[model samples]
Target: MMKLWGRDTSVNVQKVLWVLDELGLPYERIDVGGPFGGLDTPEYARLNPNRKIPVLEDGNFSIWESGAIVRYLAEAYGAGKLWPADVKSRALATQWCNWCQGSVYVDFIVNTFQPLIRVTAAERDSGSLAAAAERVGKAFQILDPALAGHDFIVGDELSFADIEIGALMHRYFTLPIDRPALPDVEAWYGRLKTRPAYQKHIMQDWTTMKIPGA
Candidate 1:
């Protein structure tokens, strides 16, 4: 049986959970981060040296890094679906996945989310937060046009690329901040919300993670 080590609150962990649910792969999920903190233990370090929340253990093989784990599952299990068989389509999907991790996640989740949600109003830097939010909006501006004629990134259907990027949509929309009008991205997000797997994994309430008076 496959075992996933991470708390469900993590967007990265949600990415894996969404993939597993989409692929219809059954696995046991162990809570092990944030409030459940076992990541620093020696036993846990053997699984992931970085002490990150998500670590996929498939029998004797163990893999960390959420992006790498998602790619592994897509390649190993999702052929025509998430992985995409065509060479050009596969390459495009891969590009979007990398873009999500490198560009989107960095600007939206790391820069904006961490400071806005985790830091209290008294301790937070308003200027920095504003800058980060502006950067995130610009990042989405680049993504908005890409969805002009498509329902999903890389293609008309859902793929691993969507899994990676869609995982952050809940947070992006839920954040208590102003955003520019992005009709195409909004439609794309609406489509993602219709998926059962996405609803189950990515559409989680993040009220608890928000710092008081933030």
Candidate 2:
């Protein structure tokens, strides 16, 4: 059996979990990081030098970084399901996966989520939060058109790109912020919600991460 390390509430960890479930791969998950607080240990450091959550151990092989783990699982196990068989299609999927991490994740987590959820109301900077929201919204605007005629990021079928980007949809929609009207993006999110794996892993309650009254 494979082993995974991370807390369930972590969005990065949830991305890996979603992929594992989607591929029907069996794995044991050990809680660490965040309030669980096992990341600083030497053993944990050996698993992931960055001390990040969501490390995957397959027998003697170990892989860290949520995006890499997701891609590894999809390519190794999912093939035509999550990993696109065509070279060009796979490239496109990888492109969106990187875009989600590079463009969407930073602004959403640092500028928006941390300010609104992790910080106290008195400490929250409305200006920065609003700016982040705008930037994230613009990022989604680029995505909305790409999803206009497609149900998933790459094509009609679910792909690694969806798992990478859709992992953040729950937070993006649930966060208390002004969002521009994005019909295609909203429709894509609705499609993702219909998946059992997505619902189980991505739709989890995240109130634990939020400060009281936040």
Candidate 3:
């Protein structure tokens, strides 16, 4: 059996959990990081040098980084399910996955999520939050057209690309911020919401991460 280390509330960790469930793989999850506070230990450092929440141990092999783990699992287990069989399709999936990490993750988590949820309302900078919202909105605008006719990021099927990008949608829609019209993206998100794995992992309560009044 595989072992996963990370708190369930973590979005990054949630991505891994979602994939694991989607693939119908059974694994033990040990809570760590955030309030659990096991990340700084020497034992934990050996698993992940960055001291991140998620670390997957599959027998003697160990992997860190959510995106890498997702890809590894998909290729090793999911085959045609999550990992696209076609070379070009796989490339396109990877492109979107990287795009999510490079563009959406930074803007959403670092700029928007941290400011609004982690920080208290009094100390929060409205201007910076607004700017972050705009940046995130613009990022989604690019995605909107791509999803115009497609149900998922790559195609009609749920792939690694959707797991990477769609994981952030719950927060994006739930957070108190002004969002521009994104019909296609909204429709795509709606489709994702209907999935049991997505609902179980991605659409989790996050009030604990927020300030009292925020």
Candidate 3 TM-score, C-alpha based:
0.98
Q: What are the lDDT figures for the candidates, one per model?
A: 0.88, 0.92, 0.92
lDDT of 1: 0.88
Residues 1-214, model 3: lDDT tens digits: 9999999999999999999999999999999998899999999999998999789999999999999999999999999799989999899999999988888898899999888877888888899989989999999999999998878888888999999999999999998899999999999999999999999999988777787766
lDDT winner = 3
Q: Residue 58 lDDT in model 3?
A: 97
Worst window of 10 by summed lDDT in candidate 2 = 205-214
1-214 in candidate 1: lDDT tens per residue? 8999999999999999999989999999999999898988999999999999799999899999998899999999998788888889889888888877777778787778988888888998888877888887888888899889977887787888888888888889989877888899999999999999999999998887887877
TM-score of each: 0.96, 0.98, 0.98
lDDT (Cα, 0-100) at 162 in candidate 1: 86
lDDT of 2 by residue, 59-111 (tens): 99999989999999999999879998899999999999889888989999888
Ranking by lDDT: 3, 2, 1
Model 3 ranges off by over 4 Å: none
Better of 1 and 3 by lDDT: 3
Give the better candidate number (1 or 2) by TM-score: 2
